[model samples]
Target: MTRRTSKLDRRLVAETALRLLNEVGLEGLTLRAIAHELDVKAPALYWHFKDKQALLDEMATEMMRRMAADTAAPPSDDWRDTFRTRMHGLRAHLLRYRDGAKVYSGTTFTDTSYADGMEENLRVLVVAGFTPRAAARAWLTAYSFTIGYVIEEQAMGPDPFAGTEGYDVEARAQRLAAYPLSAEAGREMFQDHERGFDEGIGAIIAGVEATLLRRGA
Candidate 1:
């Protein structure tokens, strides 16, 4: 059989790896698997990515690049509000593929390499009067939270509030027996993760503003 590659480059390899990632998840994602997706021999991929980690870095870059392309600033120019919108969009983007956050966490995010997209993120904060260090910290803090949040979100999978469904109604009720508030809180919290993420982001942004931007430290 002909090697499936059509002059494979880093972009093609990364894009193919991304699709495989969504289908098979991070653990299942391998260089060989990406090579198969690219219709090329595994070794053909090495001409573009030296190893799985290199491929992963490129994949992470692609994911972040796509998110930057997809994410739009909020209607208003208020930095905090715009930041919130971006954070929300970031969470949604990270959740696009299976174990997306896990893959992202592993990337080197090199400035001179494939799919490096953190510049705009840092620029926004720094332009808003954040010291370079503070801006990096702010973006990283929000990004880290989003990653951690999505890890939990994906793990929760289907029917997070298990007993809420009709089939498990009885079991759910019994499990929550004598703990009405716990059941109520779970339902409220899990039912609307967007709100929870927003709240957490709001807290982080607010804290940063109060402590860093205000104090000018």
Candidate 2:
């Protein structure tokens, strides 16, 4: 009964921590803050988590658990499509919370379930004729690109052009005149976030495919 109760408390603490992270982000998150939110003392949280990092690890695992679920739904015949869907889901989930990308980056989870999601991705690439090492490397490359892109996109704010609302197109053109290439391509450069994400994902997949083809030949 004591063990059962302890397990229950740990689960509750993890859930509450997740909620706090989504609400306040990592910077403002504290064991005391979470305890107070749960109407319990900070020491009570220590019983479950030794420190803030331990708590964060659990929270990050929870996020990956959700990602696993989102990605595990259906198998796609096209490996690229499967990978892109997973990335899209990840980006959408990360954007749901303030600083969600920051919380996810640089976090490692040894949870078998999350590993299963990655293994599934590896299987897709393997089926596409990639050697295991290449497939794994491609997965990491795609994951890194997706994470980096989301972080930058989030940092750019909701509207990249917000502050330039009053600026006329001619004025913008004049301002960018020194950089003729940028001036000519400025509109395309600041693409819709979704379009940019798709483009990046496509590029990564294409690069991996080209590498595989060259190796095969």
Best by TM-score: 2
Residue-level error in angstroms, candidate 2, position 35 = 1.2
Q: Over the stretch 1-217, how does candidate 2's per-residue lDDT look in tens digits?
A: 0112334365677667777765666678888888887777679788778877777677777778777776655357688788788888888887766567777788766366687777777888788788888888888888888888877776655622232232244556689999988786645544477897898899988898899634744
Name the regions of candidate 1 deviating beyond 4 angstroms.
1-5, 72-76, 110-127, 159-185
Candidate 1: lDDT of 149?
87
Q: C-alpha displacement of 205 in model 1, angstroms?
A: 2.0
Top candidate on lDDT is 2
Per-residue error (Å), model 2, residue 33? 1.3
Q: lDDT per prediction? A: 0.71, 0.72
The stretch of ten residues in a row with the least summed lDDT in candidate 1 is 159-168
The C-alpha TM-scores of every prediction are 0.77, 0.80
